[model samples]
Target chain A: MTEVVAREIIYCDICSFPPEYCEFGGTFKRCKDWLQANHLQLFEKLYSDDALAKATSTLSIEKEQQISRDLEKKQAKEEAKMERELQKKLASKIIIKRIERNRRKHVISISGLEVCNIDMKKLAKTFASKFATGASVTKNAEKKEEILVQGDVSDEAKEYIENLLQEKGLDEVKVEQIDDKKKKPKPTAP
Target chain B: MFKKFTKEDIHSRSNIKSSVQRGLKSKFLEQFPKLEPAIDNVIPKKSQVILIKCEDKISLYYVENEVVLFQHFDDLVPSLRTVHKYPDCFPKVQVDRGAIKFVMSGANVMCPGLTSAGAKLPEESLPKDSVVTIYAEGKENALAIGKLTMSTDDIKSINKGIGIELLHYLGDGLWKLVE
Candidate 1:
């Protein structure tokens, strides 16, 4: 039997669409810059003045300009939105709180991590395997999701969180570790 | 479908038995006979296939962490990633250049877009509710998958609203669902 040949399409790294269709992806300017950097020949073939003219030559000049104007506004708005999201990510915080279940036992609950760019459930699974304890994600009193690991490994968890934040380029993100103790009367020399 | 899909939409995932895999392969081949030649290369006999059940009864077939196909109800539709690899194996329709922006944004294809100057429809029109891959006027890669709202003849004659119902598109959650 003979093998059938398949087509190899070049997708733009920035927008994840074929380079020819990147103009419609809202991130057009960035996609163009990326294509120019990675594949010079294809970039010239798609974006050169002659090629651009041929692509929209069928449309009336006025209509073409109108569409382009709308696209430009969209691209600007998209760029601004992306910038805002990045700033938000950089400003977020993660708090690892050790809530005292009793005098001898502590439950490590990681809060304020909802803003982080990782999956809480998957992280809980990893923590369960890594710490050899029951690690699960559950909503706290305020209805925010937090990972609860059943053990007193607060220092280890803090170190792990620091390393994780560093790897994600969020070194400025403060992983605050706080210890909580319930109000209880001390046993009087029992 | 998949307009605002996120990881939260996934309910569960499990590996299917080889018998079920064979049944799916045969069903896919029956839908698109042109895919028979490259079926083995696409889905190897020994490879493990995982079925990820998502919200709204949508189930995705994943191989090597990449979603190759999906099923909504009973229609077995190939993903855009799969369309890019074997474009010739599917029935396709090209929309005009002007519609590229709207299609990329996950909008339904209008009849005017299908019958416009730059677009081309098949000589023998396909029936309604048939799944077809969507390509743009000047683009080499297929942008989305859609099901026909009416026959191609009806689209040409009517030249009105919503000719094709878009299922998935370029930068949607399904496209971005890389584990």
Candidate 2:
């Protein structure tokens, strides 16, 4: 007697494989169409192109281009405003002030030389040797980097800075002095 | 055995010029002729090399994202750990589970640990003093890198004594420095 062995073939609704090897299946186009027809609710829950497009219409290419152009115009306007503000700051003036550190002790601080493009380290070193005082480059409360020299050397510093700027070919560099209100003399008895 | 390294010690080493670095690369390739094709890919022309002086002097060659290669001692041997970064770049030898602790502790690899049951070694012949990565039994990552003390035939025949001299192992100074 001869025995017959039955073989069963299974086709994947997802791909060419028997569903166990779905990852190996390259494309899901046929499976997508089958699901769209056979399982409408499941397909709609899984993927809805029309609904996604409706939800993110503003992010579409045409809308995005329009928004990007508007953003570019706004950025250009802001950049021009910033440039004007910087020019105004450069034109204003340089202020050299003397602040009282303690009784009979004061420190000289120079600010607004940021537009000059001079090296701060070199400038500080020059001021230290020229004025015979310890000088350092530091940032002020306003977040502006400036030079601070020990002892009150505002008058000497102002003249030196003006001469240095002129030597560097910056003709319009202006130096201004600010009086220390905290160090003012007390009123005498009447 | 490994030596401790400070940040300053690593930084003080001079940066090798591109021309000199090329010479070093050629020397390394001469030692391991099998790595000719993959050498360029590991240490590209744009990569930088720094000569670090240590007990076994090391040359650290690296780029921003990847540590390309490091040369040790007068031999200028290429780093097995770095080459192992690229899968199958070098032949691997699997040690028995009993040897995993010893390997991690930076001990010389024993021949029995490699020829024992459940251990594996490449079928191809590997020359003496060749660099090969050591992996623990059933593990995917290489646990240590060593220089083969003797040829593959010697290991197969004798199946005893030290097979490879452990150069860099897990938790060693070189591993920490690379990290």
Candidate 3:
């Protein structure tokens, strides 16, 4: 008991559960394939022909069939949900807007990042240090969360966002840049 | 409790003093004495412990970005990741294969799941509201954590209704949060 050994459990890359518990996860098929490809020995030990037969519960065959059928339905629904989310990600675009704060100063506000799945606060922190300027996450007039960077770094911000999306395998995602100018008052002639 | 937890839900995070860390470790050990030997390994002496306050009164103790435990009320319950590491340290109950999917989907543990053949209630019946690590049939790792709504003995006799209120489960929001 004094040894204090902590168990090292291997988790499935797809579902993030220990391999033994992947059957209960929504992405069991992918998890199983990953386990099979990465840890063939463990995969065989857990999911091989006889292992699967023995792993079956004491429940009646009909009940087991019903459970498997229910699981298949759930898995299909999960797949459809993920498909819709991916489509949404692909269809959406990232917008970097340079808003004129004053005659000489400008601030960049990046929005439409709902698809990237990156943390806004963390990205803002990175932008703050990377550009050596004030950066923060704030809600825009549209009520969507946007990263507001002080100073005009619209192109740089766009490149940064594009690179971020690239890292997430979303290279096809569009990073749109735009400029916003405030209307100026004209002197009235008496 | 962490079914819908996310990073945005966190309100504040502050590192605790070493003395407080020692106290937290001791308090955790006191609750689960079976963890006496592995306590130091899990919560290393020099490791930083962060107290993260989140929405809805949930407070999590982060040991190097890994949330070792959390508290919603008086009792401090270990996260499932911690439970998986030292599963034997906590009192345990098993849910039958039939209930595995439901439990994975964050459902409460019903009496039938605990009373069924593939399932097991500990020999020494635990009291109401005691934290229990939930294992599933033929599974090597603990799949969930729950508090007994009814005593183990009562669950065996009553054989109906919810036996355990599930707090955290594999693949739930909290599980994905740290990962």
Candidate 4:
């Protein structure tokens, strides 16, 4: 059997701050060794022996780094969330439906306004299927156009149309004008 | 690395702060129409100012002192930002009938024609209706700025309501021309 001898460790007798310097000739290194030999009584009261050396009383560098990263990610997430919400809310108001009914033929017209600044062709294409029910828009060179219901448009239906237009920012607009003398919609060849 | 602040940046910031203050002041005046002295204090001297580029449109609010502020859509929070981004998309439909400037669809918002409402919000949301003074204009009649009732979406869907409860035509058409 071989006999093992442990090396003698030195501890500092100093202030609460980490011992960076020494008055004596020898230098002290490693907080764990310093705490164990010199301040064993204080160490026992402050923290458990296994954890005492690494535990810092003040803000640690690692903790600070984590806090900064978290703050940045939060800000970015908030900005992205706001952008997404804005797009959703804005997109909802762009389309409106107008309906007209006649005994034989019905005509519903949707017009493009200068202020609306929408892609008329794209909008026209989007609702082309719904517009199939006698709905069409005529883009006049000088004036704005509307979806004309060839037949009587119910109050509820007209209200819906007006709401869509208002959401799109077209103020000073009038809807649901009844043509007392109904005219047949221009016939389309299938 | 540090980037030096430019003269333009300082100028713009000052102008924006002052303009915001002015706008807030005007809003206060509108609320207290009877306070003559208070209103007069808020109005700045016309000659003592320089032109500020508000919302990219120029205005002579506080020029001589070089404290002009530009009011952009970004200055406003969520609701205003939503409308400013797409002014023409909602609340308006083109007139199929010939010879009209534009026709409003009372779908999302109600304008001019005061009546019943269809949206969830009540009439109190409408900015108090009043005639305001038109001070300036932007490109293609963009209505540089005006006090408005309800958010843009509110006006569009309300079947019976005054969408633009208070409109100050910023340019020529604000007041009737004396022929």
How well is each residue in B65-169 modelled by candidate 4, as lDDT tens digits?
A: 322222333222111111223333213211111101111111212353323221122233434332221111111112222334555445545644544432221
List RMSD in Å for every model shown: 2.6, 21.4, 1.8, 29.9
lDDT (10s digit) by residue, model 3, range B1-179: 77787878989999999999998998888888899988887888889999999999989899977999998787789998888888888998888888998998899999999988889889998999988999988887899999999999999899999999999999888899853
The candidate that wins on TM-score is: 3
Tens digits of per-residue lDDT for model 4, A1-190:
2222222222234312222211111222234366667777745644465433333223356853554455456446655776686565444332223333445444445443333555444444544444343334564455655444333333544565566568876544555333333556779898
User: Interface RMSD, all models, one decimal each?
Assistant: 1.8, 24.7, 1.4, 38.7
Give the per-residue lDDT digits (tens) of candidate 3, residues A1-190: 6756778888899988999887767777898889999999999899878877776757778878888899988888887888898888898888888899998899998899878777788989999999999999999898889999999988888877877888999988898988899778787887
Query: What's the CA error at residue A133 for candidate 4, in Å?
Result: 2.0
Q: What shift in Å separates residue A81 of candidate 4 from its native position after superposition?
A: 35
Predicted complexes: DockQ each: 0.63, 0.01, 0.74, 0.01
Report candidate 2's interface RMSD in Å.
24.7
Candidate 3 chain B minimal-lDDT segment of 10 residues: B170-179
Clashing pairs in 1: none
Query: Model 3, residue B33: displacement in angstroms?
Result: 0.7
Q: What is the DockQ of candidate 3?
A: 0.74
Which one wins on DockQ?
A: 3
